[model samples]
Target: MTGDQGTGALAVLELLAQEAPAARIEALLHEARRAGAADAELAELARAVELARTVQASAYRGRDREAALAALVDTAHDLTSPYDLDSLLRVIARRARRLLTFDMAYVSLRRTDGTSYVRTSEGDTTALNAGRELGEGPSLGSLAEERRAPVWSADYLDDDSVPHRPGIDAVVRAEGLRAIIAVPLRSGDTTLGALYGADRKVRHFTPDEIGVLLSLADLAALAIQQAALLERTREEVTELERFGSVTNTTLTRVRHLWDCHTRLARMVLDGARLSTLARAAADALDGVLQVRDPGGRPLTAADELPDLDEEAVTRAALQAHTGRSPVPLPGDVWVAPVTAGAEDLGVLVLRASAALTDEDVRLLELAAQSVAALLLIQRGTAAAEGPVRDELLQDLLDRPHHADLHVRERTRRLGIDLDVPHVVVVARPEGGELGKAVAWSSSYAYRCGGLKAVRRGCIVLLLPGSDASAVARKVSAELSPLLGHPVSTGAAGPARGAAGVAGVYEEAGRCLDALTALDGAGGTASLRELGFLGLLLSTDHDVDAFIASTIGPVLEYDETRMTDLTRTLDAYYESGGSPTHAAEALHVHPNTVSRRLERIAELLGEAWQKPAQALEIQMALRLRKARAALRAHRTP
Candidate 1:
């Protein structure tokens, strides 16, 4: 029995001796396959053993071959998709974390202004304040800026020179992080950004890993470039669409005006009622241009369009008559002389919401030129005959008579549509410099015919067929910015008969008075709807009392000291009571603004607390400034 046991033990020892070492597993498998193992069962056993040995060897090396293959497949899929730059970058961050077995991953972009920003992250972005300016930091951005290459640190805690927050370091330690790998995202010569990954355990990142990250970043750069190009293309297309819409709308209105002109002319020459022709013109131009008589009176009697300023239009008409170059209005107003031949009949004015493109201007000029020739023919016929002359005369007489009858007669004889409802806008240039104001107002008036000037101020006429209120509002809105200050506007109600237009003129004059009162008081006011007292205050106010009682202390404070009380008041008015915005405008701290405003409240007294009283005080201040500026200039 002992001998048999020893033989069995020897056989076991032989089997153990033939077993392959872990390192030589692949070689042992090759050898076994090459050798002639005749028994099928034995050969199968050998193959199984060799396969197990090979897998064991791979595991010992910590090589996750299947995981690596899956990661490669995911990367290939990401590269093929047509995602935008930001999305692709996010994918890259996520994939990198998985591939490197990292705790966190992120991407950052450099700006032209020498600032760097974190754009994407696999972890909580808010934790890192991603996309915010890296004001003072030694981060991946600084490394990328300096080397323009990949950087890695295995012992970040040892590097005291690196600027990283203690909280970040604590998180890194908690996660068992040992190293970081960063690769610059570049395309050709341009460096777009940086991609980084943090490993949870100590490990050396091979060159192959960096190469893979770089290849992905290159793909991201391509996506960014394409997205920018697409955005630019969309903007261009949108602009073209807007331009087309405006042109179509303007052309349609012009055609309607031409039809109205023909009907009105027939009614006047055939001894039809003047009111009928005037009403037709008023109806045609309603909500467009305020039409008025030569003296700047509204044409429609009862149903008034909103009041409009017509000073710019009148100036343009006079300029055209004087043989000057065509004047341009604020909203691309185009004025063409209305004449059959050498006998100047009148003027044709066309307006556009946008600055007229070259093509648009040419088309409008052509339409105006045609209207001008028609007016001349009509005027010649009217001058030869007594009453039934042309459509222009009948249209003119339809509205009220103007104070300047000679100008009105000339307008009628010339066959211009003067019977339209219109308003006059007077503009007195501010800032002690009249040249710029004169030039702006003059050019603005000449483009639209209802515009004119009396002395240094300009008067604009809203046309008969236009929306008087809308036009006035638009004019005021446009002119306010150009004047660097608020401008006053007067609006007239609609008038039908020749006599009724005078009442419209008087209303417009009242509007002007209101505007003047608001301006003199240095207050922000609108005349859309006003109470009786508000209207009265706007037109007739106790000037001495306003200066002495209302604005007395603030004016005295400004004269006596260098305190910013006056400046604060101006800023408050300018910013419309937004303390934050006022602070920004004054270039001081917000707390400083709060303090100054508190002081201003105390100085102005309780009466100034009310909005109405505040408005009155503001108006008074502005008027004083305007008067002072005027006086200063007069002294010279």
Candidate 2:
């Protein structure tokens, strides 16, 4: 028995020297009991059991320390890894599971309203560990948040210290989670959320376990903050890029507008037309352009867009004319009014693919203003030239048939060809309408390339045409309405030169008088149309020619035969064709008058006694007696 005891003690010492673990120590102790050792052997077996427990405790502690260190190193590497927020959270949960040697682990972030939702999870098969909210009632995560410290619940479903929720209990039971430990994701005094480790089998949480999870929680908090800041920075960078784009666009448009303005201004200075102005505006704006006149006629080519709205353009133009800014139309069209002083010259319509900015509208307005200025200059020049043209016209038509070199030169300068067939129109307005007539005549004269003057209380125009009647009709029609009175016009034309023009004027004047006598007010006539009256009023009439056409034989017989037969014929007509009354006037005997009458009758033809022939004979004899009296008067 003593030897057996000694051997057992020795074997126990050998086992200790061999560094045998607890299992071998227990097996040897069981064998010693079976062999029924002495008290010393049994005592020695008991000592070995005590020593095995100590060695086992030490080895377990060493392993736990090593695992904790390895877990910390892995967590540090994970935190440094290039992972996004989600990936980082997953890594933290996974690392927490490894660190705590738990079955499951997860991360939860507290919402702004003090509720927590799971952020990431690992080793979870139920909603309990992933995607589940730590409900409003007490939970491991909430406990951690409220205390701003680490918390744990062994048999969480039955822990009285934790405020239990039925739903959370149900999920935990379904996920086979019997214990859970959580540490607040805290920085300083504020808790951001919670990090959790869970186990399927009931387990007690240690201070070291809580400390490891707390470190992970702190790292998670830092990662969450960094992610938030990075996200914000990205947003700021995007906003800056947008602002820079807008600024660049504005600057480019401004430069484009400057170039357009410079080119348009230069064009105006160079006397470009409205069409050119429209084209320049279109080119500058990258659009189609149309310029319209006051009459609504397009001064530029039409746009190719088939759906351009004419009515809308008109309305927009009207609005702009009232000093309102240009209005937008459908299809990205814009209309700006073109005005010169108070006059609305026209509108400018532009069509582009995109809506214009306020700067673009301003550019269009500038173009419109430039166009208005061009129109104003043109009108001013025309207004200034009006009087000058009127003066030149007056010189061309002035009368008295003066052969002055100045008149001829002026006529040439004025573009009047008196040598050509030209007509003169005399318009007489009744009822005190001379001013109106003059105004009308002035415009009419300018349009017709004619000259107007007030002569003999009538508007006289020297026009460049041969048809006097046509001119007279036109003057009467045009001036009558303006004067608000009846206008009578007499035109005489196809006149030879400036010198012969005076004679035509005289004829035209007599025609006027004849029209009035004949109650032909508002009548137009020429010399040929007036018949015998035209000859009487002619300035170029010859008295000798009148006598020859009437009684040429009687006058020739008196001169050739030295007879008084021509005298008898005149006296006979004065006596109503009776020779006896004519003889008494002549102080000659009736027989002598009768013989002369007989001779005169023989010289004159039978048809000369007719009423028409008699009238001609009477006029010729009267003209001859007037000539003889005029001669006697001149000789005295």
Candidate 3:
């Protein structure tokens, strides 16, 4: 064992270790053959000689060399494979332990807030069981924060400045571990976290080994970023699907609303009462509107709606209209102006149970606009359809036996729902001012699929697919609102064919005359809720008695003074108690007209100026005229 010989032997062993183990074995066998030993001796000599003739040293060196190379290959394959973050990190940790000859290894990742977390680990049970929170000491944490490349600590436990976990120091001391390597896990300039490894004995980590671990950490960081991107993409797709489903459902509901509107329009065109249509519209809207008068007074509300102040809604509507913007209120409520062109129909207020986004607001506005258009279209259709239906009915009345199958066929073709029992409702507008009201009412009825006709000052509504009582009640209700004065509706029972319809029309006229007589006498009346005056005016005897009782004194006064008291009373009623207008109508001085009105009022008593009294006097006047005509006709 000379010093030169020893140096030569060490160099030979180092060179042999760099070669593969199998190649080294073959070189050893060739050396034995060159030594010229016999066949049996050569076999013994080949078995006995190590590369450097140091059995333990050579074996340890060879094993470590092979293990390192295998680890390098494994790590290369892992880096190329398409795996998720967690799976890829576990592979890195396991391979790191083998390549670096460490007791443990781990991958830590930085949270969004700059804190680092141990995401993967490979080690003995005691160290691995610390979970993800382990090994995030000051050294590793600082490396992540500052984006430092790598940090090495020899005698980690002895270094007071280096951070350590609770039992980590004890484990390091017990195992005689003396070195740690921390490499930053980075992608581009962004440092994600750190990869750490520890050896059981003091060892200087080479720059080459640190570079390899850093490269592997970079791959792990990329996987983490990719996983996050994939998750985000999945969320976006899910939201799109949900939006499509919701839009489809909304379209289906809109179609149902259109169908209801069509049915209601037919009713209006047929001159039917609009009360049923109003109820139907309310039902369709659900709680979309809280119906109120023009003055911001509440009229009716659905049961589910709270008792809201109409004044508040009106104020909100005014603000919205003035500003030309959607106005928000408490409880996620909003009000939109229901306008068509320049016409301000009203306001639609909505209370959403959830926060409304821009999309929800736009959709609701569209629905409101549709409703306004439907209202206008229905009104126009009813106006045009009313007169045509009335002319057809009149022609049938004039020639009962004429070949009028054309009218019947047209009615059938219009798809009128005539199967149900129906009645004729005739309303002779009070004061002969029913033309405009009738036009408006007919428009409304046509929109609701009811038939309306105007002849002279009277408006007739033919309610199909409705019972007599219901038609009567509905006609009274709808007309009452539009006239601003109580109107009497006469129901002429059920009728089928055109001839039957004509007969019903005549019956309705008779009933109208009777009801008008009652109304003229200042009486409360409706076809459905008729009182004693209804029965009294319906029969000839009762009609005579009513005339005598109500208008006999006025007639006597007019005949004795030749003052045209009837004309004076008419002038007073028409002028709405305006003395000047009444004087002009009577062609007399204002004072004179005023004095005559006072006298009439005094004679009729204080009750006569009231709506009830006015109604009674007007009915009495009509009854008196009808009696006079009846008597004159009989004498002729």
Best by lDDT: 2
lDDT (Cα, tens digit) per residue for candidate 1, span 1-636: 244334433433344456545444344435544664335534454555555656465443223433443454456445434456678778878887877677788887877776677787786424544564565456655676467577777666665655575555665666556677777765435676778787655667765466455545544454454344334544654676677754666555444443444454344334333344434433443313222322234322324333323677778767765663345666556554443223343454544445655434433333333333223222222222211222222333344454456446644533434567554333333344555454444334433433333333534343343444566665666556656765656655454434554454455556666756655422222233332333353333445545655667766786798677777777877888788988999999989988877877788775565877777767766766777788889955
Put down candidate 2 lDDT per residue, 427-536, tens digits, no spaces.
78877757757755665565466666777798777788877787788677666655566887777766756676666666777788887888988667655455446558
* Candidate 3 per-residue lDDT over residues 190-266, each given as its tens digit: 67777888877777876446655654554445445535533553465467667775466655554454455445444
The CA lDDT of each predicted structure is 0.52, 0.70, 0.58
Looking at model 3, residue 263 earns an lDDT score of 52
| Number of backbone clashes in candidate 3 | 34
Off by over 4 Å in 1: 1-82, 159-178, 242-636
lDDT of model 2, residue 564: 83
Global lDDT for candidate 3?
A: 0.58
- Tell me how candidate 2 scores on lDDT: 0.70
TM-score to true structure, per model: 0.29, 0.36, 0.36
How many pairs of residues collide in each model?
76, 0, 34
Report the C-alpha displacement of residue 97, candidate 3, in angstroms. 90
Candidate order (lDDT) = 2, 3, 1
Give the clashing pairs for model 2: none
